[model samples]
Target: MPEHSYLGLASAMHRLTELVIRAAMSELSFPSLSGRASCGLDAACGNGDHSIWLAQALLPEGQVTGLDICREGLLQARKASAKAGLADKLAYIQGDLHSLPFRDRAFDWAWCADCLWPGPKSQGFLGMDPMPVLEELVRVVRPGGLIAILFWSSQRLLPGHPYLEARLNATRAACYPFQEGGSFLDHILSAPVWLHQAGLEKIRGQTFVADLHTAVDGQAGDDLAACFQMLWGRAMPELSEADKAQFERLCHKSSPDFIANRPGYYGFITYTLFFGLVTSRPR
Candidate 1:
């Protein structure tokens, strides 16, 4: 992922899918989090997108701390939170996900987005064991508090090109968070089990979908283009010449047949969250 383009891409994605994100959050209940003193952590909160969401959700009282490994991202997050006038309720910090910077039971809850693990080693973040990272999340959250881990579970962007899309998805880049010899536990849906292993209780899962069925224009169109890149960015080596040509024809923003430009285009992606409660303090 290009550092220069992440903020814009992230911003566009947030704008495009905020409705579904909000809907997903609405279905979740954290009675304790609504209080004025409750403190929550937005783990790996990039550009403070979900951090702002958390802040708004805990409105009129609760405070949120946004933590990320990237300083640039935290800077952008600070700007964004301040712009939203949530600086009072939100704080930014630079820290590693593998070892959170806070103390034991520091927060009432933890909301982790697609940041629990790194992407392919060939990409920006060197892929590593996520168990330690998850343990850190559980460590900082208080007993009886909530811990939520979210993932970009699936995407259906290349309409009418299921085969190509399937192949693209099969590529190593698409199957993220996969270990070289990983088991089913490596899958995103296995998050509940992760929480269970980390000693969380009431393990459960839910998925939220962001669908683009209507007209997509201007920045949204470009953002959709960026989404295409992220989904199948590194599949060029795996795709045949013909497949590559077809991918460019349909996916590239400059192409006349770009999916976003076509009439009645439909694409949807899902964000799934697996949450559980800390039944007892970590020993």
Candidate 2:
């Protein structure tokens, strides 16, 4: 699992992605609640942003339970839920995604965002097999329920200044390797196959691009630059001193010599959401 402290930048990125997904979900005519109160499970719920959003969207009698392995994240999640006036509709628990603590058929639907990927321990450093996790989600969701998995596609650096682009490429190469001759995005794109093998029906996937570009003087630009800086700092152990310096210069939003001085200073990250229905459990 990623460290709890990583949520700051991650939360920022997630907020952007969630907005895109929320719009898509609305347009797709997602199912509406029936007679009984609707309930949902947010697996690996992080800071509970998604849980709260789910509750809001599924109202008037909807509730969401959020679970994560990171206690600190749940703490923040609880706080955010309270601040959003969604405390009554949202609940938080700390539990591993591999073996969820919920009972069979515990939720009407289950949601996992960026949590199905292999962790750091499995072969190729690609993480563990996601089958167990998917199975667990299947077990917890009632028949006819829905399961949604959202993840980021490989990042594409919009054509920026030459120096900045080179540094960004080097950073990406150092941080992410093409495991088994495929990039992380390739692995994510294969999730529908996993869902099928897990016995899910009505499996479907769609990609969304969140345009994160902003002018250097704007808050959005500063936030995105900060996220890049945080990522670079986390990868410092694997980065050369020269690379680190270059990243620092480029990510420094306030620096007069920053890369944003070049023409067309903007950034974007794409995300994809794959979802399926739990039609029935394997006998």
Candidate 3:
């Protein structure tokens, strides 16, 4: 885990690439998404992991431009894309998602992942109205181009501690980016409605699950630990002493009674993608 980082974004994503790739791309048909598109946009690309993969898998010959507002993230993205041999097919840009720095209808396709958790001033979420961002996404895509927005929908960890897990989820910290002051628009399940309201056609959604069982030692274990940390680290203060002890025993890799070390251990995380096609603007 990286110091001063809430989620240990880069390291976690790296260690979880196996599940990440499957969970993110499982429902996607790259051939159908690509077709005759010559250029693609990875909007708000955090580390460019998905960008590089999408470039190689979705557009074998087309260029994929990754856009983000964070300078450091873009720098890391540039490095990662280069390291993945996608330096030729990938480019990184520092830009805001709500105000994409591209001409109208500039991209043939667009992909944005884990970027639309909504709350007032929430760092993890995009922290504002997602409608503006959706509108911007629609504006820049060609009339017939595809636009996909992905959300890290849900996860069921702690196989036997459903009650404790539920308590953890009830905490405001655990639901940070999805706390109070949000409407139906903030909910991930309403994504198709968002796309339709933003003037996109053929809006649809699909969810992919990444399941793992009793993983210990290796990237999977590390990733599982990171997932536990990311989901419940901040919620510790809200938990009771017993709950805290249980969480520590289960989530801490150093604990003698870690959950993953037990037999029949199973956990799964889900990623949901909602996509729509840009439509011609009214004359």
Clashing pairs in 3: none
Shift in Å, residue 77, candidate 1: 0.8
TM-score each candidate. 0.90, 0.81, 0.90
Compared with the true structure, all predictions reach lDDT values of 0.79, 0.70, 0.76
Q: In model 1, where is the ten-residue run with the lowest total lDDT?
A: 117-126
Ranking by lDDT: 1, 3, 2
- Cα lDDT tens digits, model 2, 1-283, are 1333357666766654566757645533334634566788989887888788777778567889999877878999999999999999898989887778889989988888766665454322225568888899999998888888887664554355556445555554334433455544446678898898878888998887766545533556556665566445556665677867776776677766565454566556666778888876554
State which candidate, 2 or 3, has the greater lDDT: 3
lDDT of 3 by residue, 1-283 (tens): 1213522456565455446564565456555654653688999777777787778766467788999877778888889887888898999999988789999989888898777766554334565578888888888888878888887777788888899989988888776666566676677788888888888888888877767765443456666777788778888999999999999998998888877777677787777889888886661
Ranking by TM-score: 1, 3, 2
Worst lDDT 10-window in candidate 3: 1-10
lDDT of 2: 0.70
- Give per-residue CA lDDT, model 1, range 1-283, as digits (tens): 3333466578777876787787666565544543445788998788888888877877467788998878988999999898999889999999887778899989998988776554444554425446787788888988888888887788898889999999888887667547456777666677777788888888989989998864744566777888888778777888889989988999999998887888878889898878888877535
Clashing pairs in 1: none
Model 2 regions more than 4 Å off: 15-18, 24-37, 122-126, 162-186, 230-246, 259-265
